[model samples]
Target: MSNTVKIQRPKIPQDIKPLDFCPNEENLFELCIIRDCSIINEDIHRIRFEQVIFKNVIFKDVSFKNIELTDVIFDHCDLSNTDFRNGSIHRVEFIDSKILGLNLSDASLGNVFFQSCNANLISFGYSKLKQVLFDSCSLRNADYYESTFTKVAFKECDINEASFERTPLKGIDLRSCTFDRINVSINDLAGCEVTSNQAIGFARLLGLIIK
Candidate 1:
């Protein structure tokens, strides 16, 4: 596979009509099927999506901050430039979603699974992530600075240019994952393995001169 990441839009259903109002209980079923639809330049502040299945939906430039989601599945969604900042998500699965330019800073994630997703440039700074599995996701340029990770795994992922500055990396194995130029100041990198360039990148994060 080429390293060039291509941007693909989410595939929306043909039968569903466009959502003109804030999400409610009755119309949520139809809205769930409306994937790849753009919510640009609009404010979706504090909309609660409980037990919702948002399959293949595209949320661009929308704000989902301070919202509560439970058992919601966002499959194959394009969440680019969408803000989930300070939201509460539980038992949510983001499968095969394009999460580039997504702002998840200080969000609370518990029992969340992000499988085969492109999380490039997604920020998790100062967030609370517990039992969150980012399996086989591209986390390039993603920031987890000062975030709290518990029982999290980044298996078989490309974490190039990701920032973990001052983030705790205890027991986080980098053997299965690949890194290109991850920033890692104040992170425990003794057990992590890297190439020559990645080693230099780690040192640069620490501001240390390698001999």
Candidate 2:
């Protein structure tokens, strides 16, 4: 019998199409499909999206403050430096995306899945994440200060130099990931799983001399 952990895949909606124009405050989107669009440096605020699907979209430096997204899926997108501060995201999946330096501070995410994404330097400070999965992602220098995580899994991810101050990571399995110089307190790392070599590195961080 195999005891390997399986990551959950995104449940994408079948009906979707290409979107041309950018969303506005007046015309809010609902149950729509947006694809192959570039919304660089656009400020999108107070918009509500329900069951929306975004595919092959590039959202460089886009501001998404206070947005409400439910059952949204982003596939093959580049969301570098996008601001999602204080947003509410539920059942959202980001697949094969470049979310480098993405700001998700003070946001609330539920049932979110990030797969095969380059999410280096991403910030999740003061956020609440529930049932979130990060698979095959690069999360170097990512910040999770004062955040709450429940049922979150980090599979085959690189979390080097990541900060987890005041975040309780009990029972979290980090053996499959690569991490070095991680900023985490001893209490925060309680019950977290690590490899033998990683335990040595963590011991070194605790001023232990392993001769």
Candidate 3:
């Protein structure tokens, strides 16, 4: 089976300037561009960012709960160990970002793209993802328990030791991805596309000897 599906890229704003400090009263930011900024160890909650472009930004160990992100593009950013729980992220793109150990539990993500990102140990438990694309990302040991995926694509990703319990992967293509060990039920793997070698690997997972 061929994996020729192209992921939808982010729609970035053209006219944007260096984002200054946001007003403390309102956590609402729109059409702003933030680059080379470090907001590490900061607790930012209930913030709403619209049409924002973050490039080479560092948000390490930041707490970003209950945030709303719309039309956001995060390029070459470090969002490691960031708490994005209970957040609403729509039309967002994370490209070439280091999002290792990021927490996205109970978040609602729509039309999101995670490309060439180091997303190891990332958590998506109980999250709702729709039209999301994870391309060329290292999602090793990532957790997706009880999460819902609609029109999601995982292309050329490393999903070794990833968990997908109670998450249905029907109609999802896994031909371009590689996984040595995955935690998934047989029923959840139904209607999923895989390569011949991957099929053999799956057979081994089922304790079947393939000659």
Candidate 4:
């Protein structure tokens, strides 16, 4: 059994059509690429996207509540303050995206990768994540209250002041991540892998006076 954390990639077709217009009245979008477009002030529910690639798209005041995305790749997109609560995301990759203040509470993410993204102030409350990797992302002040994580990894991420209260870090490695202060209980930090410097900080946080 291999202990490596390998996330699945998006399975998009070789031939895809470009979406020129804004998504409206469309419940299910498949086999399409929405690039260089802006979706603003649109309130949509249960919108399903399959095999879609969103590149350089900017979203403002868009609410995709209970959305379902599969095999999706979001590259160089700006999804700041977008609401994606209760969404189901699988095999998705968010690369070089600005997701500041993005609300993903209660979302189910599987095999998802977030790389080089500005994900500060993101929320994952009550969400379930599996095989998720957040690499080189700014996750300052992010919330993960009561979230369930399995096979999740954070590499080279800025997680200062991130709240992981009630979220277990068992088997999760944070050696490559940098954080000044994070809200996490000692019990939740059990079995979590960290660097020596981080361990010293944790000891200080526990009020332990080390010689």
For residues 32-76, write the lDDT of model 2, one tens digit per residue: 788888877778777777777888989876787998878788889
- Against the reference, the lDDT scores of all candidates come to 0.72, 0.84, 0.87, 0.93
> What TM-score would each prediction reach against the true structure?
0.76, 0.91, 0.93, 0.96
What residue runs in model 2 are displaced by over 4 Å at the alpha carbon? Answer: 1-13
Per-residue accuracy of model 3 over 46-141 as CA lDDT, tens digit each: 988888899999886689799899999999999999999999999899999999999999999988999899999999999999888898999999
For model 3, give the 10-residue run with minimal summed lDDT.
Answer: 1-10
Best-matching candidate per lDDT:
4
TM-score-based ranking = 4, 3, 2, 1
Output the better candidate (1/4) by TM-score: 4
Report clash pairs, candidate 2.
none
lDDT of 4: 0.93
Q: Pick by TM-score: which candidate is best?
A: 4
Q: lDDT of model 1 at residue 91?
A: 77
Reference-based TM-score, model 4: 0.96
The residue pairs that clash in candidate 3, if any, are none
Q: After superposition, how far is residue 158 of candidate 1 from its true place, in Å?
A: 0.4
RMSD of each: 6.7, 2.7, 1.9, 1.7
Q: Which residue window of length 10 is worst by lDDT in model 4?
A: 1-10
